[model samples]
Target: MIDVGLLLTMIVAVGVPSLVARWWPLTTFGEPVGFLDVAIWPAMVGLGVGRLVAVALDGPSSLGSLSDLLIIRSGVEFWPGVAAAMLAAAWSAHRSGVASFDRLADLVPLALIGYAGYEATCLVRDGCYGPETSLGIRPPGTSTTMLPVGILAAIAVVVGAVVLHRQLGRRASWAVVMGGLTVVAGVRSLAAIWLPHIGDGLTRQHWSSIAVLLATVPALTAGVLGGHPATRERQLLDR
Candidate 1:
């Protein structure tokens, strides 16, 4: 079977910028970047980082031999890819003379939706799953199942993307949109605790989600206090 998770990531990696290039409102930063920088660069960097982190998580065994690093099949983790993409966007923006945060803000919508799409693949693959429940839906031939964690995550990301996309152009604000993204991470983490298949202790995803949530708290607070860009612009216009 085709690796649905990897397939979705590739789709999002390519599809988002293709759409942005044509219809996206031109931003001071994004306006300068060609599709290769925005889409291709991030995807390539993300894939490398995703593999690196997965190997790191594999402990001494993965680090024992250089050959272990070449096992690309085992390095297909999701959150690492997202982290790499974020960093890659910032680096690319810096190299291209665009504001890092501005470029990040522009990409947030697609990133969130991409994340959600990635989560949806769990439905088709034996990927990360939640704790088994009496109410859970099982795949064919399986006697046990868990809560639809992936489906829930997908819903959260899609909704968050829609909320942020409304602020495209001059109305975009990192505080508002990224705050929403952080909330999704925190929520998915909270939900994951009840999942039966997460194995023992806090997994990498849990730690990353918590880290993201903690990091985003200040931004969310500041955004709520300072108000969204749209509101500020409207206030200025009123004056």
Candidate 2:
């Protein structure tokens, strides 16, 4: 069982800064750097390392086993997903011509908040709660008591959307929202791996999950790149 209080605390820690950014946006005297720019790489690096380690030691098959699922559900996958999405979103923002890195720094705090919230959801769902353990505190109906990584990812999404909104305007906000939903769908699709034998079967469920991930990579890239400052500035200047 995971400690709900600690899980919530983690979410708050990551999330509040982003909300604060909305009000007291980060600034170097007066420049704005989007929230995604700051938080994306760090979150991604953390997630990439965790996933790489798990895959290296246990293989992909260990990803959705009951024990593994507990970990995933606990938000183990949150940071990686946030990292990937943030990178993708940042690239999209840069390409969109919405704002420069200097102008966007203020947005990082908000994105962190969203990532935290997302991970908290995972903790409640027991997605990555880990196996039974005798150490630390455990929540009811769970073996291990650890914070989920998804909370951080969710915080990223929330904050990312705000940053996109601030930089790219409403259109980018919509894109962020859509992209976030797609990621959720992809996660759900992958979650089927937890189902007994369903994951073992060669079917669309697995393929769909892979497809979503594959699709997300390019879509996110394009979104970020397409939203670059030079491009948007030109578009605005033209209009």
Predicted candidate 2 versus true structure: per-residue lDDT over 1-239, tens digit per residue: 77785567455645565556667565532466544445656565656555555454556776556565445423344334544655554565566554443323334435435544655565454454433345433545655554333433454455554554465442344345445545554554544443323345645435655666676667666666667546687899999
Error of 1 at 228 (Å): 3.9
Per-candidate count of clashing residue pairs (backbone under 3 Å):
4, 71
Query: Weakest 10 consecutive residues, lDDT, candidate 1?
Result: 28-37
Q: What's the TM-score of each model vs. the native?
A: 0.75, 0.35
In angstroms, the error of model 2 at 175 is: 4.6
List the global CA lDDT of all models.
Answer: 0.68, 0.51
Compose the digit string of candidate 1's lDDT tens values, residues 45-154.
78777777787777556766778775666655557776787788888778979877777877776666555666676755565466678887675466777677777877
lDDT measured at residue 37 in model 1 versus the true structure, 0 to 100: 49
